[model samples]
Target: MDNLKFENILGWKVPEGSLPCWVISESERLFSIKEKKPFYDYSPCCYFKITQRLDNNFIEGHLGHSEYKGKRFHDDISTSYEYFSNYQKREPVYFSFDRVSLYRLIEIIPNKPLSFILKRVDSPKAIKPNRAFMIMPFKIENLDNFYQSYIKNYLKTEFNIDIYRADDFNDNDIIIETIYNQIEQSEFIIVETSHPNKNVFFEFGYAVAKDKEIITIQNTEIEKNLFFDRAHIRAIFYSFDNIDPFQKQLEHY
Candidate 1:
């Protein structure tokens, strides 16, 4: 992207026959830029509600209008609305954000003009959710499954907010940095208090200091050990066999 030059991002587009084009609004555009800070100038009630990130120079997430003019994205990113939007297909697609123009404000429309500047990369085993972060131990039985299948699905479906845990990403070279990044990106957090982990507490403490909306989840069987009481937030206790109580309690948040 450094080599390619474009003054304005809106004028950009995915390349011809590229994985697909995802014309991002001003909000998604802010994420692609380095210096500017306003998320989006205009959006239709954040209806599309999707997220994307540039990792290893590749773009990942529900690339097509997760900012949905539709339900899901297909290979022809230009189309594929009104279907199950599954960017979480166990494997993630990686693409690149490109620019064809030299100036932000200037448009050089050729005889055959095109704007999309995204390139597809065949990367695998990576899924990212930017809205919420989960801080729980990986060692817990079926806990990861509960998060991925039940919790992640519910939040994305009900609230359009995607949740991710540290283990969700295949890469953890700089584990602490990644954890901090997720915390910073998240609008809220769902942390576990059952069978508490020290590192989890440390991260939770950092989030508290940052003034993030924190929600705790714990198994009913485990006693709350050295409970953290900050901002008067309490943990939502649920049973693995019955998640009904947790679902009902989450609305209070």
Candidate 2:
């Protein structure tokens, strides 16, 4: 483990000099973003044509370009699990999904603006996997139901994750310390900015301070504006419709 805390890499935007990854549709036009990856040279932007938007947030698309080919195995641990076991290595390796969609990663061209796009062609379904983070909006009086339902769905749907609450923690003494410790260690934070609650605001501030990923969702215009001021802080905003879209947004991250 890198002993480094997650805060060490907050707001680290990808350099603008980086190239774009193309997502092409079947008609030979390019549009729609499946995900983004680091840029690499010698790898042209791959293309995929949208075939259908399957129910349950799964999409079906056909691959148009083969410059960067094959579906990615998102789980790096499984790919390396046997190798590490054979070597008797106990150290955990850090994997970056941000690099998965990049092309020519195996080889790099020095200093050129490099880009790679992974296109989806002829895939039966574009799966919208549940994000590791949970988003809870407090205005819904059924806080307990909302929290429980999210946890249950994630567990039932086979999503592996780390969960953290952005509010309801006492700021004095051990409670604050314990909450901070948990947030510090978490991979994601859920902000319930439904009512502009002071506690939720504090929690959001802490998440921003620590540089952790956040998922902010609310139903009203007022709540959206409340979070709008903190655009400097990176987060995915959801206006109901489909929670899966927010999940897709996180997949890109």
Q: Which numbered prediction scores highest in TM-score against the true structure?
A: 1
In model 1, how large is the Cα lDDT of residue 198?
88
Name the 10 consecutive residues with the lowest summed lDDT in model 1. 99-108
**For model 2, where is the 10-residue window of minimal lDDT?**
102-111
Q: Taking the tens digit of each residue's C-alpha lDDT, what string does model 1 give over 1-253?
A: 2112221333333222222222333334434454323222332111111133335322223333424444333234232432222222322222222111011111111212112222332211112344889888777668877787668888888878888888765342234645765676677899887765888889989888877788988776766443546437766878789987788787667
CA lDDT, every prediction?
0.50, 0.38
Candidate 1, which segments miss by more than 4 Å at Cα? 1-130, 224-231
Candidate 2's error at 223, in angstroms?
2.8
The C-alpha stretches of model 2 lying farther than 4 A from their native spots are 1-140, 166-173, 226-228, 239-244, 250-253
- Tens-place lDDT per residue, model 2, 25-45, is 222211112332121112223
